[model samples]
Target: MSQFLTQLGDAATAVEAFLAECLAEQQANGTPPRLAEALRHAVLAGGKRFRPFLVFESAKLFGVTREAALPAAAALECIHCYSLVHDDLPAMDNDELRRGRPTVWKAYDEWTAILVGDALQAFAFELISEPGRHEDAEVRAGLTHTLAVASGAIGMVGGQMLDLDAGRLPEQPAATIADIMRLQSMKTGCLITAACEMGAILGRATASDKAALKTYGEHLGSAFQISDDLLDAEGTAADVGKATGKDAAAGKATLIGLLGIPEAREHLDRSIDAATAALHAFGTKAEPLIEAARHMGRRGS
Candidate 1:
């Protein structure tokens, strides 16, 4: 357990360093100094950075070294941070707090926050699509394509649209479990799955190995979002680093909202089990990824 924690910590530190380097490069390029500062504040505000850890661990399964995969991992982090900055906008969740601090829009202004998200998202593509990270052009293209789809309308953006509509239609017919799952899968699951699959792409894994990693990512993403729902349903704001109970307060659709807490927890356990089972193909080599899936399910426990 200590070793896993150490590895996760190391991955987080390495990702931060890559992020800093990118920021420094932009600063040197004479991007507006304030925009650069806002970008740093938005991207550097601490979070678990679990997505990049997923990338590195999944790539490790293919014997790919972390340094070789860091650019792709950093790309995913950029997308994730961009989403958060936009999610906190007045047009979105309108939260004043993020990572237990004032949100970007709160610290800066709404326009700056929007531009920060734009910059991070553009930078994400730049990180992956740039030359020299991958020897093969095909690999870089694949990573860029996957990240684009995951961040765009078919994935996170679509999910956000559904969530916004849900908030507006509080009195509308409640969504079924299938509907809720579909929404959550797009909103939160696709990007996560992208992170894991991108690792396979980075390592040039066999089809079977890639499939297994994708399956693990699917289950892990579901479990991760379910845990987030549970946290908002039961955890305090202090513990969660953001508003709690807002899902219910806004009448948004969630597994916990649709099935209730006990059943939701039961579903989360099933998802976690499926995630663990997906790693059976990797035997003992997948311990870190396995632990990561377990960690997702155990959030707020």
Candidate 2:
């Protein structure tokens, strides 16, 4: 367990360093200076780089070296950073802080932040398509495809639409939970799952291995969403990168509002259990992912 935590920590630091370098390169290229600046600001905003760590660690569980997954990990962080920027825009959640710092829109202008989100989204694809020294072109393409599906209209954007229309959803608890899950699957879970599976794919892991990692990802992703809901109920603006308590305040349907905080916590525990079970097939090889599941269960921590 200790060793797995050490490896996960190392993987996270390495991925963050690589992502910063890529952001710097994008800034230095500066052909479209304003767009590049916006993109760089969003990417270098000091994120946790959790999705990137999942990419690297999942690859490791697939028996691939951490070095082999660097490109995919860095690319995933770009996508996540883009999402956070857009999510905080006035037309969206209108948040002011992210990672305990000013949101792009707050620091710059709304227009610049919007463009930055767009540029980062494109840059994420560019990074995914532009393989690192150790990664292959074919693998890069696959990783890009995975990320697009997770972040596009059919994924995160589509989920946002549902969240916007949450008031129209059936008032039943089951219906609300289902709707929340649908919103979360796209808004939160899909990209995380993509990170893990993309790493496995890049590592040349067997289809079976990739599928198992995906299962682990799905459960963990679900827990991540539930944790977000719990955080909104129990956390403050300082603790969460974005705003909290808005879900209930807005009368938006969510797991916490639907099932209550205690029940939501229980649901998160179920998700963790499912995720841990999926990792059991790997024996000790799954320790890093298992710890990740536990981490999601304690998201604010």
Candidate with the greatest TM-score versus the true structure: 1
- Stretches of model 2 off by over 4 angstroms after superposition: 1-9, 131-135, 167-175, 236-244
Compared with the true structure, model 1 gives a TM-score of 0.93
- What TM-score does each of the candidates earn? 0.93, 0.87
Q: lDDT of candidate 2 vs native?
A: 0.77
lDDT of 1 by residue, 256-275 (tens): 86788899889889999999
Evaluate residue 197 in candidate 2 and report its C-alpha lDDT on the 0 to 100 scale: 90
Query: Tens digit of lDDT per residue, candidate 2, span 1-301?
Result: 3554576667778877777787777667763776666666787666557787788778877677777778778877877887788889988788998778888898889989988877777877787786345457777777778888888887877877777666445663434567678888987888888988987887878888888889988999999888877776787555556555877667665677678778888899999999989877789877778887887676654
How many Å off is the CA of 277 in candidate 1? 1.1
- Give the Cα lDDT of each candidate: 0.88, 0.77
User: Number of backbone collisions per candidate, in order?
Assistant: 0, 0
